[model samples]
Target chain A: MTLAAASHGFLSPTGVEIAFVLVGIATLGAALMTVGSRQLVHAALWLVVALGGIAVEYLLLTAEFIAWVQVLIYVGSVVVLLLFGLMLTKAPIGPSPDADSGNRWVALTVAGAAAAALVWVVVDAFRATWIDLDGAAQGSAEAAGRSLFRFWVLPFEALSVLLLAALVGAVALSRRGGGAKGAAETLAPAAREGRL
Target chain B: MHLAYPAVLAVLLFCTGLYGVLARRNAILVLMSVELMLNAVNLNLVAFDVWLRDTLHAGQALTLFTIAVAAAEIGIGLAIVLLVYRNRGSSDIDRLRDLAERPSGPDGAGSADAPRQPQPDTGAEATA
Candidate 1:
C-alpha cells in the first residue's frame, strides 16, 4: 500500500533517478562554486548544497541512517562552525586579498593527477564486481541504531572522547586570558588577545 | 549503472578539494577543501559498502566516525586559523613564507593572528 503511494508520488524510481541526476548536477555545480567563488559566505552556502547532494545520494542508496546523520552533522553543525569561525576572526567579508594566490597552477596539476589515479584504480578494481543492491540490506533505523551501539561500540566511544577533547579545546581556545597557569596557560594569552 | 559512477564522482570531488586546499591561500578555504575531501571519501565508502552488501554495515559506521573526526579536526583547525589571522591580519599562506624560507628573529616571532593593515571598525567601534 505504502509502496503504491510512493510510486504515485515523485519518489518513484524514475522520479527518484531524475531527482538524483538533477540534484547531483546541482551539487557538483555548487561544490565547484564553493571552491571557485571568492566570497566566503557564498562558499559556505555552496557547501550546504554539496553536502545536501551527498545526503540525497545516501537516500537513493537506501542508507537512511547515514543520510540523516550527514544532514545532522555536516550540514547542521560543521558548516555552522565554519561560518562562526569566519565571523569570529573578522576575515574580510569582502574581497580577501589572498583568496587565490601563487600556486594555483601547481595545485591544479597535482589535483588532476590524484583524481585520475583514483578513478583509474577504482575502475580497474571494480571492473567485474557486480552490485546486488536493494532496500532490504539497509534495514530499519532501529536496527542501525542497535548496531551502532552494540557492534560499533568501540569506535563510538572513541568518537565521544574525540568530541570531548574538541569541546575542551574550543573552550580553552576561546577563553579570555584566565591565567590558569596550567597547560592552558600557554594557550590563554593568545586566545585572550584574539591572536589565536 | 555501476558503482564506478559514484566512484568517479568521488574522485572528482576529492581532486577539486585537493586543488582548493593547495591552490587557495585562505586558511578558511583550505579547511573547506579539506571537508570536501573527507566527504568524497565518505561517498566512496558508502557507495562501495552498498555495493558489497556486507553484514555489518561497516562502511556506514566508518563514515559516521569520519564525520565525527572531521568535526573535531575542523574545530581545532579553525581555532588555529583564527589565531593565525589575528596575529598576521591576513590568512594568506604565503605571508608566512618568509618565516619558512628564512630564519627570522622575534620581530617575526609572533602568531600569524596579527593583521598587516588597520582593522575596520565594527558598529560598536563606529559608535564609540
Candidate 2:
C-alpha cells in the first residue's frame, strides 16, 4: 500500500481530497468557535456545525452509516443536551468576559505544543499512506449491521446495558433530595426530633 | 484520499478540544469541547476503517460504540453539572474548588475552606 501510494503526489489533488479539505476546514473552524465563543449557547450551536461537518467527512470517506449515526446522535441529541444544560445553569446570554479561565494562555500554549507534535508525527508516519475509497462503501449500514451482529453482538449488548446504567445514574443524580447526603439530611431532622 | 488529510484534521480538532477543555469556564462548554474531541476520534476511526477494509469492521463498530458512550457521558455529565449548579448557584468550573488545596497556614487553611463548605449545606437546607 505504501509503495504504490507513494506515486500519488501531493501536487495533483483528487476531487474527494478537495471536498475533504474544504469540509475539514469548516469543521475545524466551527470547532474553534465552539471552544472560543463567549456566549455559552453559541458554543453549543457551533458544536453542531463542527459535528455535522465531521459527518460530511465520514461520507466523503465512504462511511455512510457512521456519518448518519454521527448526525443523529451528535448533531441531534448531544448538542440539544448541551443547550439544555446551558439554560439550566443560567449561563449568561450576552457575552461574558469571564468565559475563558485565567489560565487560558497556559491552555493555548499546551494545546499548541501538542498539536504541533501530533501533526508532525502523524504526517511523518502516514505521508506515503493512502486510503482507497473506491469500489463498495466500507461502512454501509448493511455491512456494518452484518458485522456488528455476526462478530460484535456481545459488545453491542454490553453497550445497551451501559446506556441503561447511565440513564438510571443521571436520573438519580439530578433528582431533588436524591443524593445520600440529601436523604440523610431530610431524615436527620425527623430523627433528631424523635419523629422516627 | 491522502490518509494525512483526515489524520491531520483529527489532530487539529483534538487540540482545539483540548484547549476548550482547559480554558472554558462553563462546565457545559467544556462538555462541548469534549464532544469535539470525540468527533475527531470518530473521524479517524471511520477513515482507518475504510482504509483497512477489515472483515469484522472493527473500526466502524468501535465508532458506533464510542458514539453511544459519548451520549451516555453527556447525559451523566449534564446531570452532575446541574446538581452542582443547584448546590453552588453557579456552574463555573473554577468556582467549584472545594477540593482545592489551601496555600495558607493550617489555621488559615481551615478558615479558607470553611466558607466554601457551608454553601452546599445551606443549599441542602433550602431544598429540604
TM-score of chain A of each: 0.76, 0.86
Worst 10 residues of 1 chain B by lDDT: B119-128
lDDT (0-100) at residue A43 of candidate 1? 86
lDDT of each residue in A1-196, candidate 2, tens digit only: 1222343453588899888888988989999999999877788888889999999999999989998999999889998889888777667799898999999999999999999899878888987788998898888999999999999999999999999999999999876673556443444344324622
Taking every candidate in turn, the Cα RMSD to the unseen true structure, in Å, is 8.1, 6.3
DockQ of 1: 0.34
Best by DockQ: 2
Model 2 over residues B66-89: C-alpha lDDT tens digits? Answer: 999999999999999877766556
Candidate 2's error at A95, in angstroms? 1.0
Give the per-residue lDDT digits (tens) of candidate 1, residues A108-149. Answer: 889879977886787667655444554474735775777788
Report the number of the highest-TM-score candidate. Answer: 2
